[model samples]
Target: MNHGSQPEPPLDTPFGDWLRWALVRNGYDPEERGVQRRFADASGIPVATVSRLLRDKGQPDVGTCYALGVTLGIPVMPLLVRAGHLPPEALEKEPQPTERPRTPTTEEEALTALGVIDETDRAAVKSVINALTAKHRQEGTS
Candidate 1:
């Protein structure tokens, strides 16, 4: 993941920022050489499209956002919201009178339920989860 000497320029748009963060979270350094092509191949998006997105040169379609999310193991809703294809309110849950709300059973589910859509926040939460899981495993072994 060595990106060499050139630093990555700041992503001006929210979607661009999120895409860059998600790429890093998924172990793809945006600054690394051939990252755009690699990510495009992984996500099944065209290399040119991926390049434009990585460079923050154009807007992405909903399908592109969903494809990237799937490739990154992130929920597509957040991507859609960040890409402006959907409003922030789209992520809010509506009450269902017939069914009771179920608690989140996994880290991803918990993050989604808590609306922790920011990639930075998601990474922090994942780090804490990993630390806690490791500590618990150690304690159990002891």
Candidate 2:
């Protein structure tokens, strides 16, 4: 059976950049989370494969493309396009409106703000927060 058309990128375009954008937009920071390693873990693809892909070493097969899309919460078609799997006509149509990304929760904001501090201090703060949270849970309070 024929797989659907895959969008093709020009030889000059760095498809890995597309993947990076998708990952960042979805809150998977390579810098913070060991990008390739975490993505490999999440997508069940090999770390070497992800590394090669990031390095623009090869094109992913349909299944790999799908895995990356699912992991990053991005539309697979654009990824397919970047992978040169579809015809140019596929992207000629109008784009769909996507939901706005959810705002970070107060806790997320606080933790992110804390992330700017020294790593040891941040760890200590996180430990304190965890202990307080556990105590609150024990007391049956929100």
Candidate 3:
């Protein structure tokens, strides 16, 4: 596996259905969850769509698959590849770079070049930093 990529698994038959079951079962609660709520929360998919998928098994579509993967915190590539929806090599391909590595004139210039914001609305940046710092301080020296 690459630094950022996970190995695509070879899914057994009934993989897609099983995946949904696994995700929901892993987070399952006996009385606290309905299929719509669990499916939406687990897959980041719309609850209605989840219901539609459950109702119309072949109609869930890409959005449903993608949402389920995202919500489950598993990459879509692995699932698709495993399920024969995508070629295995597709998962290993790196995204095309839009530009070359930037070369700064000096070390300090390079460090300074890495800015969190650039003409973007950053009103809450300080607040987030402060909150993070407080959290870190609370955690102490690990």
Q: After superposition, how far is residue 39 of candidate 1 from its true place, in Å?
A: 0.8
After superposition, candidate 1 runs with Cα above 4 Å error = 1-13, 94-142
Candidate 3 lDDT tens digits, 50-142: 655544344445665576567767677666665556776886673657656667885345445666353342435556656888998899942
Tens digit per residue, CA lDDT, model 1, 1-142: 5333334333334566667777877788988899888998888999899778867787789899889878988777767767777777777853356667788998788999999989999999999988888998989952
Q: What is the TM-score of each candidate against the true structure?
A: 0.56, 0.52, 0.41
In the order shown, what is each candidate's alpha-carbon RMSD? 17.8, 18.0, 14.0
- The lDDT leader among the candidates is 1
Q: Ranking by TM-score, best first?
A: 1, 2, 3
lDDT of 2 by residue, 30-134 (tens): 556586787798899898988888778988888898998788776687667778888656777635566554456776566675464566776788789899999
Candidate 2 lDDT for residue 138: 96
C-alpha positional error of residue 112 in candidate 1 after TM-score superposition, expressed in Å: 35
Clashing pairs in 2: 5-86, 6-85, 6-86, 7-81, 7-86, 8-84
Please state the error at residue 117 of candidate 1 in Å: 44
* Alpha carbon lDDT at 15, candidate 2: 74
- Model with the higher lDDT, candidate 1 or 3: 1
Which run of 10 residues does model 2 get worst, by summed lDDT?
1-10
C-alpha-based local distance difference test score of model 2: 0.71
- Best-performing candidate as measured by TM-score: 1
The CA-based lDDT of model 3 is what? Answer: 0.56
